[model samples]
Structure formats: C-alpha cells, structure tokens
Target: MRFPFARVVSLVVAVALLLSAVSGFFALFTARWRVASLPGTQQVANHTFTEQIIVGEYRTCVTLRRETPATNDSDVVQVRREENCYNTFPVNLFWSSRLRDVSTGEKAYFIGVCWINRDRVARVLGIPEDVPMQSLWKRQCFGVRSASVGTQAVAAAMAVIGGAVLIFDRNDKERPYRGMILIAGLTAALSLVPLVIWFGVVKKPGFDVGPSLRLAGFTWGIHLASFLALTLLHFCHSRSEMARYSGPPIDREVVTTQTADRLTPTQARAGQAAEGFARLESQA
Candidate 1:
C-alpha cells in the first residue's frame, strides 16, 4: 500500500504551528519577561526581605525572601518568602505612584524596577516622590507594553486560523494554500513585532540595572520560536509554489515527433493516413 506522504507532511507542519502559536500566548500571561535581583534588603517590622523583581507584559511581581539566623546548636536556618504582584498598568494608564489595595486606607506602591540599579532599587522605592515615579512609568513604556500584548495576541490568533485553514483545505485543489501562506506571513510579522519592541525596550540604557537584568524568560523564547517557525513555513510554501509553477511541461501527444522517433515503418504510414483522414473529416 502507498502512503500519502504529502498529506502526512502537511498535517505535521500544521500541528507544529498550532502548538507553537498556542504557546506564544503564554507571553501575555507569564510573569517572566524581564528579571532582576536587587542588591539590598527591606526591613518591614522585624524581617529583612531580599528583593527580586519580575516584569511581564501585563503584570509585574516581586519576591521577597527573609532568612532566620541559624542557632548555635544547629546550622539549619528557616527561610520565608513573600510575593506581591501588581498590574503593569494602574486603574488609569496615566497613574504612576501608589496602587490601590482592596481594603480601605491601604495602598501598594508600584515601581518600575526595570530602570532602577540593584543598589538604588531600595532608595527609589523607599522615597515617596511623585515626580520620579511618574518618570519611571513613562507613557512610552506603557505604549510599548500595550503594543507587545496586541501584536502577540493577533499573532496567536492568526496562527490558529492558518492551522485551521491548512487542516480543512486538504487537497491543494482549492488553492487556499496561497491564503495560508499569506496568513503565515501575517503571523510571522505579528510575532516579530513584540519581540522587537520588548528586546529594544529591555536593552535600553535605563533598564540595564546593576547585576544585569536578564531577558532570559520562557515567553521571549516562545515568541522567538514562533516567529522563526512561521517565517520558515512561509518561505517553504513560496519555494514550493515557485517550483510547481516553473516545473517541466505536462505530457502531451505529438504525432509527428512520436511517429518519427518511436514507430515502425508500417505504424508510421498508418499514423500519417489517420492524420489525413482526421483533417478530411474536419473539412467535411
């Protein structure tokens, strides 16, 4: 039995694209885009909390860890970790300082650790100045975050559509592959936009805090993979199309060439008589 090799290959490519596209959306939900470990400790009452900040497209979180001193008898220490997360944007996009807590008269301070140096994070967050905080949450930063979210969402959506189209249009007969390739191109572009925006934003001078803030998160890697897959798929389709259109001519009957090269003398004479009869019949 012969296997349907082309169909199987198409299905595999579509499945891969679908999975990567779905995973790309995790960038919006995952809080691992940019990471930094601050140098100093925060003293809240009796506990001194060491800080690490994690920024995502939509939300940013800080993990504060405190360790109890080991006793003389035993070297074991007790450690407690606390995490606080806040929306990247406030109730209003313009608001920069304190984030409103659920309970009355309680507030959580929001700071952009992306710009703060490791040693300066403590001082920056400690001070209650409105002006510098406003500078940190610049309108441009908010715009970039918003744009990244939008492009990533659209890229994932386009990838889903492309996969569905590939699955449904099984036979290249309806010629929807062109549309599929176009969708792939769109998906690639959309996926690329977020990567460019975030990479550039993170590499900007201010975000380069001491100890080097790393963009070593899963979301960025996923986005990069999705972009590469979509791009490679697009070019593959284009090359296949070019080959299909520019391929050798289809088989056709040529009595003159065939009779001369492939027929016996008796067969050649019969072919000539048949051609003459066919012409006569058409004239009649």
Candidate 2:
C-alpha cells in the first residue's frame, strides 16, 4: 500500500499548530506560576511595586491557564522529563513586545528584566482599573527602556514577511490556502504584543510590530504546511471536477474470441512441440 503521505502531512500540521499554541501560552505567562494577564482571561491583581518614575508602572498582572505542572512528578514522568520538553527551557520576551512609558513616551526598557517578560513597563497602555498601574510605577519595577531600531526592524520584517507569504500564496498555484494559514499565524503571532507593550520592548509605536521570531517560527511552519495542503486539495478537487464532464470516448469497444476451427499445420506442430517439452520436463 502507498504511504499515508496526506495524513502524515496533516498530522505534522496538527502537531505544529499545537506546538505553536503551546509556545504562545508560555511566552504569554513567562512560566506556569509567574503572573500574567491574557486578553480574555480573568486577572487577579497579584501585586504592585512603585519605585521611581523612571521604572514606570510595574505590577504582577496574573491570569490562569487550563493546565499547569505542580511538580515534575507524573505518570509519564520520563516522557515529561526527556521527550517533547516544553516548559523546561527558558522563555524569552524580547521577541514580542508592546511596552511604552506614558511619562517619557519611550520604548521603556527595564535593565535587569530586559527581554524575559520581566521588563518593567513605564505605564502600560491598557491596564484595567482592577489592575494597578499608577502605584506600580511609583514602586520600582525593573527600570524600563526604549526599543532599539534593530528590534523594530525585526518586528517590521516579520509582519512584512507574513504579509508577503500571504500574497505569494494567493498567486501561487501550489498553495491556495495561504490566506487562511497567514490569518491564523499572524493572529497567533500578534498575541505576543501585549507582553511586548507591557515589557517595554516596542516603543509607543507605528504598525505595533507583532511577535518575535521565536513565536513567528512556529506559526510560519504550520502555515506553510497548511498552505501546501490547501493547494494540493484544491488541485485535486479541480482535477476531479474536470473528470466528471470529460465526456465519452469517440471509438467503440471490440472483443475477439478463440475457436478450434482455425489452425495451421505449423501452429499445430509448435503446439505438439510445446506438449512434448512439457511431457519431457514432467518425466525428468
């Protein structure tokens, strides 16, 4: 049987999407325990720190995840410890940021907490009243700083590339589904901005660049696979539709039958020879 390449490709796409989503969550929350506030999630005002105006407003905005690791002990301990390591490695925040300081209106970079989602935002743009922004600024959060042109360059590049991928997929016969894939990917990629803004990685900005390369990579990977699948699917569909109306053959079918009435002496001799050979082999 032929290998299940289509199913295999689909599985690869599914796995990649799951991974992209998982990493997205990790970037959002820094860690399972660290405080975070996602778009729809409920926020529990963790804590607030006020130091100097320079630090801006910093607070431990906490949110929840569906599942978390209490400890490294589980039924699949070996698998968790060894294979498919998700939360073990360090998560970096510089890749995707939307940080800004209302006071100076800068990219707001905090020294010690620089890129690890630990950067102290000067004054977070959209903080719910339930979460403290003013008091946090008074308290010394990590000293926030501004986003450099290089960082901005990368963000702009990601968005442009993401857009280009979408366009190419449109004209491309090989990947008709590029638009849907890009939509999913860009949306997921954008999920990192709040952290960016909160972390002061991006300046009060134009285009408000999307997630960093790290997160973008996952979405892009899945997007490519999905785009290819969509293209193949459409191509197959077209071929099938064409086959339906292809019409019948212009020529009619003919059949021939064998009869004992016709036989030549040479043919009979050849037949006798074949029989003789078979009889000789059997006897031998």
Candidate 3:
C-alpha cells in the first residue's frame, strides 16, 4: 500500500496549530514582558537602595534591595531584598472604560470597578495619591490592553477553528472543498492582525523607548508562531488544490482496467509454455 504522506502532513499541520493556539491562550496569563533593574539612591541616614521591576501583560513583580554598610571601615555592605508579584489590571481597567461610538456620538457605560477613580494601582505601587497622572496613560492603556487581550482571544479561537477544519478536510482530498484555503487564510489573518495591532500600539519606537521597556515578550512570540503555522497550513491547502486541478484528470477505474487488459497476453503465453512442458514430461 502507498504511504499516506499528504494525510500525515495535514495532520501535522493541525497538531501544530492546536499546540500553538493553546500556548498563545495561556501566554495571556503570564507576566514576563519588560524586565528591568531600576537603581535609586536615597539619603536615608546614609543608606542606598535599588529596585527591579518586571512587567507583563497580566502581572508585574517588583524587587527592592537595600544595601547598608556592614562596617564603617570595611568595603563590604549588607544586602536586604524584598520581592512581590502582583496582577496587572490593564484588562480590568479597560472593562471599566466607557465606550463611545464615534460615528453616531452614542455613549454607553460599563458597570464594573472604576479603576481610574479608585486608583488602587498607584497606591499598591507606593505612588503618592496626590501625584497627578497623565491623561495619555489612560489612552495608552486603552489601546494596548484592549488590543492585546481582545485580538489574542479572537486569534486563538480562529486558530482552533482552523485546526478543526483541517482535521475534517483531511479525508476529502479526492474532492477537495474550495473553501478550505479561504478559511485557512482567514484564520491566518485573524492571527496576523493582532500581531500588527500589538506592534503598532505597544511596540512603537516613540511609545516603547528606554532600556527598561522591550518590544515584546513570550506572549507575542507565541502569537507569531500561531500566525506562521496558520499561514503555512493555508499554503499547504492552496498547493494541494493547485496540484489537484492543474493536471489532466484521469479515471482511476478506467486506467486499472486498461493495465489488466495489457497484461492478459503475457499471462496467456506463460500458461501455454507451462502446458507444453507438462506434455513433454508426460510423453517421456
């Protein structure tokens, strides 16, 4: 029997998409985005301290290390470290954000925790309540948080749907569906748009500058892999369709009958030779 290479490839693509989608979905819950060590000097009775901040889509961790002189004459210092990890509320803030339709000037309010008015994040981070925050930060949060969470969710869902479609379409290669490539392409687009939006909003040169901030983290990489896998799956379907349609069609049943007919004469000649040998043996 012939090896089912095409079926194997199709199944492999499906599995790749499923794995990528699962990773992408879980990446949303992790916090490994921007990692930095911020050093500061404070005149607290002749002591200095430094801080490290690690930020991510869903979480943030801060570590403060205080260094004090061990001895007045010694060059060594004693170190004290404190670390705490907390969940970021970007998506939560976005949920509380008011919605407005620009075209119709219609406005609707969401009933949830008022993150801005409550301002618990600043307090949690030890920022003074009297300090004013830039209005631009809210806008940035709206754009970055909304796109990161919303688009990733859509992309992951689309990828899962695409994987299921590929699995179901594997057996119908002889009469391939015309919509397979279209669905696969749409799935790729679903993954691609989120990546583009994320890059544009959060990863901009002007917005994301400085040594403390980074372009992306593991979540974005997972999304990229999901997009690439879906794109390759789309191309696979397209190539299969092109190969199936490009050549002249042949009837397998008719070809098999013709091959058997061509072999009949040879089979008859062999039978006659065997009969002659048997007659010679009988006569002897």
Candidate 2 lDDT, 1-284, residue by residue in tens: 54344334434454554555555444333322222223433322222222111111222222222223345566432211110112111224433333443323355333223323322332343234444433433222233213221232343344444444444333323333545455544544444343444445323221122333344345445545544555576567578668878665544332111332366778778887998999999999
Q: Taking the tens digit of each residue's C-alpha lDDT, what string does model 3 give over 147-169?
A: 66676677667667766876776
What is the C-alpha local distance difference test score of candidate 3?
Answer: 0.51
Query: Each model's C-alpha lDDT?
Result: 0.55, 0.38, 0.51
Candidate that beats the other on lDDT, 1 or 3, i.e. the better one? 1
Each prediction's RMSD over C-alphas, in Å, is 9.9, 19.7, 14.9
Pairs clashing in candidate 1? none
Worst 10 residues of 2 by lDDT: 79-88
Listed in order, each prediction's TM-score against the native is 0.57, 0.28, 0.54
Ranking by lDDT: 1, 3, 2
- Writing each residue's lDDT as its tens digit, candidate 1 over 98-137 gives 5333213256565444443322333323322221323334
Report the Cα lDDT for residue 208, model 3.
Answer: 28
- Error (Å) of candidate 3 at residue 79 is 2.0
